[model samples]
Target: MSDRAPQPVERRLPTEESRQLVALVRDIVSKEIAPRAAEEEEAGRFPREVFTLLSESGLLGLPYGSDHGGGDQPYEVYLQVLEELAAARLTVGLGVSVHSLACHALAGYGTDEQRAAHLTEMLSGGLLGAYCLSEPASGSDAASLRTKAVRDGDDWVITGTKAWITHGGIADFCTVLARTGVEGPRGITAFLVPGDAEGLNAALPEKKMGMKGSPTAQLHFDGVRVGDDRRIGEEGQGFAIALSALDSGRLGIAACAIGVAQAALDEAVAYATDRRQFGRPIADFQGLRFMLADMATQIEAGRALYLEAARLRDAGEPFSRQAAMAKLFCTDAAMRVTTDAVQVLGGYGYTQDFPVERLMREAKVLQIVEGTNQIQRMVIARHLAGPETR
Candidate 1:
């Protein structure tokens, strides 16, 4: 609602490098990404160059080991960068998060030779990645996935379709989970599959309600062949690797949610201050003022929740339950904040001329991505009351 740019959020950082990193990210967002976000998104154009820019800036490898070419920043720092990007443009923020998710399996579980050979390229050599886990029939019921990978000689043949992949068609590589043995979770195995490998095909991107700048598609791995050397961790360990990655990925989603919510609040406040009704500024009214107050409070709370979880992760402590709570609260908060932002703008917010409408649409996906808020609550419940028996 103010003509001035939203001030940078106050963040407590552990090091000078992180402080500088956040400043650099804000500069890039204001100059390069934010300007084109509305136009590119309306055209459904993906910002491939932005990813290149992020890669070159060393942002793509932030939470990884320096030995493997990462920036070696803590998860707290990495997620704040993601939040800054998401506020400017959610497509870039979410894309970066998904790329990090895609890299998690190999970075954490692959052999030394695998790390030396592929991790450098994935982390620092300007390549993009995707994570494959959900399937046509297994969205929340991931352990029941039907994708099969049969062993043959030193290579494995993979055949299955992965649904709702963020960078499905365009990723340079994919960290895939496929069934290699028994029927449940233990049957699964993780692999690093090249995007152009034989029999790997991505379907047309799905038409979405918002965040059109980012493509979502289904990938078909039809007997795709990958060498055994690409296998990550041991047989029957894929599900664990996938879940571990998700704990971190959920944090990413939470940060992005806060960013979107922040953006919406900014827009609402700016509009309210400038727009006048009945001979006075709408922001002068207590009703709108209270709404804005609530929105800002929720955003701050969500940010604190996610950052707390991230710190737990950086400490190498158990944080799955906290991660789930952050994901649940942040995303739901985004949804609520964005919806209220639209109401704050009244008729103007409902129209495409305002970014609030788009922000509202984009916020919906945050609730669904990584894991749905409903699923997040389920995970939290599991942690609190133990697992549910069928």
Candidate 2:
């Protein structure tokens, strides 16, 4: 238990309401989330109740339309809330982002009747949802997915496995992507399948380097059946839908990354100032002071990058390039900041006695999830160079 305070990071919210929302989120994080984060994560316990509290507080649907039981907040606000939550615990913050990703397909593409039927339950009915897209072999190349959804009169039978699913076993619903036509991206279709659908089973959660409290598992869909009403968008529109969702999800990742970096920076500064070296604080040294300064600078730059992307999204402008850029820069920044945080604490940082070690481990995952930083570079290049020659 290092007595390190989380470093302060200023936010540029657009409204008083958004500021209030961030305040509410911070209050909940400090009181309910931060206290149990280290203990529960060490025990590999998912804080399902915390999600219930978030749902009750209307934090779950912050960026969604109010018409369908959502908060109607802009992405700019919702992402900041995510950053505050992540500062306390990455599992909860990332969980909310994944839930929002799961909701995107139906919210953005489902018919009005479909929205009326399922969106309310999903958004406000205290249901937790998982996004199912990655397959065992298709981590970076999503279009190469092997899951199959065959049409059967009024129903579709989905069969195959989804890998690295968040909330895999406990989610109330799963927004699934399965191939229905020819090879490549166009064959994919999206379905909102019930979590407990017969023949749909989740494997045991994966043991990981960090963020152990968040369940990540493989899901097996063995002849799981869904009706036409469950389908989202036209046939072959799923890849596009999934891509659009990732554009937003990447921003969520960027925010979460900065939160981790900020937490690390706070820990390092607190430890350096309090711990004595040569009868004085080590922070007084120019070498350590420079490290702290660089860490703080990187975290601020990452926050600014994500907020720019978020603003573009709120304005309904093309933001995919910016989203990719933010995801790449922020996550890389988190990795650096967290690693530097551990260095700042020296031996104390390496031990479980401090949270910086955990922060470092957790920061590694953000670079890989949603899309690898390499994949982000590819996306940015495509945006800049107008797609690569085949």
Candidate 3:
């Protein structure tokens, strides 16, 4: 016990439904998820039980409409749940985001009949889902993907490899982007490809630097058959759908970045109080104190940026540029916070004995995924100019 006051516990205010949902999520995370995060993350084990708990609690469907067995919650409320979940366990937070990405095709563009049949399961099922858009050749330039889907009368035969899918091996379904025309994005189409479809397979998991518990792999669709009815939207609308999904998905990544940063800050503050140096707590040192202050400030600013973006979305304002801004800023903040957290702990932070190292590793991916920071800057710059010049 060093003489630092107990860290203040403040939460963002929410609507009545959001308040109830947040409280329930907090309880579940504290009692169930937090205790196991370390073991599962270290062992690279997926928390299937946690996924079941989230579904049963109806958290998985928070952003969808009540008609689809979802909570009909606003983006504002739903993103807060994501922030809270990320605070407890990054894996669960990211899993939710990936699941939402998988469902975007259905929610945004699915036919009424398709929505009637799969929306509920997409939202509340214990099974996870993946978004398949990237390829070996088309990462930042997703529009240039080469995976092909050939229409065969009543069905489409898809043949392509989707790279860097978050829930690749374990997902129950995948929203796939495949090239159907000869040109660029105009040639692409989106489809709901069942995970168990014939000729569909996931490669063995890729060994990643972080987010070990969440699986990543290449999804191979070799002549996988899908009814034309399974097409998510009109041909050539895939690019628009994908971009719109990213507008939301970027916010999710921002929320997770904030959570990772907060975790690192929390660990740093705790360590500073307990660690002794020069006959007093290390926290009392001006050097360590300044670092903590900076970390906290970054986290606060990052939170504000994403919240503003979420508000813009809820208000039906143009938010694509803002979403890009939030994702770029918060993830950069996360990388800094986690790295400084390791510094605050000195030698111990460099080792696996502490969670900060893992958090640091996790932060890197946020910058890479959901559009790289470079791509985000490009998007923001283009938006800053008028359409003619852009």
Candidate 4:
């Protein structure tokens, strides 16, 4: 690889503050995150301290309200920060995204009392959060989830398991969805449960192909009880809340995918310029040069796509369709670009000595999480042509 440091990405920020925010993120990444990423990831160790630092630095709550201990920045700016963090380490970037997702219900649907009670600590107090919506059987068809929340006077008892939870065992709080009425989506209700609540237990984290540093596990709620005050929105409104959170969460994923892709491209470019083939650098070859060009182009396009969606969100316009499209396109592009980066490195790319292989594995999950690309396409189609009839 080239000895020179990789140049910072050029960004269009609406204000000098946002530009400075990006610079701060980069400084933290260089000093704290990037250096230890490969080692910690290889050891399957999550860097919780880094998250604490991020929280203290006001990086954890950028897209939320300033009154609630958030930065009140636009989604456009928040997502770019995600991209920078992901470039340094996917674990940190995606962990931040999941934390924001976990905070969504309370921020958007909670009463003033609820926000006052918990939002600030959750946002900037170094407390981590997790979102619980998927069950083992209800990954894609979330409306059919079977977790039940039975009424116990002024309290509710939740019973069932949530699958594929990020930060499952470590989160300080979880925004959980459980069935509270009849079957299907309308039956669900959202509740903010303390992670250490009685009867709330986490399984061992899943063994994954990538992002091993970030835990993904199942949480079992065995009659976990919370007061009615913990309920987020109207009774039986959890599904809507979940879907709304996902519209923004998908954009976060899109940004992160581009970050991983960009990192892979940078590695490949550096290696190509430095590795001699025959009598000259491999980067000078026509075929490899074209591949590098395509990788850069795809990364740029994905960045633009996600930024446009973020802008729509910032403007308070309907952005769900664009969000779905961005999620779909950007993740696919990440997979492609990372794979091609591997090719550009020849046999060396397959080894753990380089980061591209890990990036490739991490990119695969982006297409599956939040909602699968298939789900994203269906969402877009529903927006374009309405829901399909059986």
Best by TM-score: 4
Q: What is the C-alpha lDDT profile of model 1 across 1-390, one tens digit per residue?
A: 457566678999999999999999988998999999999999999999999998999999999998998999999999999999999899999999999999999999999999999998999888999999999899999999999999999999999999999998999999999999999999999999998998999999999999898989999998999999999999999999999999999999999999999999999988988998999999999989999999999999999999999999999999999999999999999999999999999998999888989999999999998888889999999999999998
For model 3, how does the per-residue alpha-carbon lDDT over 1-390 read when each residue is reduced to its tens digit?
A: 345543533556566777778889889988998888888888898888899889988988887887887888888778878887887688899889889878988988998899998988888867678999999899999999999999899999999899999988788889998998867879889999888999999999989988899888999988999999899999988988999999999999999999889988988998898998899889999988999999999999998999999989988999999999999999999999999999999999999988899999988999999799999998998898745452
TM-scores for all predictions:
0.99, 0.98, 0.96, 0.99
Which candidate order results from sorting by lDDT in descending order? 4, 1, 2, 3
Q: Please, what is the whole-model Cα lDDT of each candidate in the order they appear?
A: 0.94, 0.94, 0.88, 0.96
> Where is the poorest 10-residue window by lDDT in model 4?
1-10
Better of 2 and 4 by TM-score: 4
Query: How much is the lDDT of residue 263 in candidate 3?
Result: 85
Q: Candidates sorted by TM-score, descending order? A: 4, 1, 2, 3
lDDT of 4 by residue, 1-390 (tens): 689567789999999999999999999999999999999999999999999999999999999999999999999999999999999999999999999999999999999999999999999999999999999999999999999999999999999999999999999999999999998889999999999999999999999999999999999999999999999999999999999999999999999999999999999988999999799999999999999999999999999999999999999999999999999999999999999999999899999999999999999999999999999999999999999999
Supply the global lDDT for candidate 3: 0.88
Model 2 residue 236 CA deviation in Å? 1.0
TM-score for candidate 1, please give it: 0.99
Q: What is the lDDT of candidate 1?
A: 0.94
RMSD, every candidate, angstroms: 0.9, 1.1, 1.8, 0.6
Please identify model 2 stretches exceeding 4 Å from their true place. Answer: 1-7
* Count of clashes in candidate 1: 4
User: Pairs clashing in candidate 2?
Assistant: 7-266
Error of 2 at 180 (Å): 0.6
Give the winner by lDDT: 2 or 4: 4
On lDDT, the leading prediction is: 4
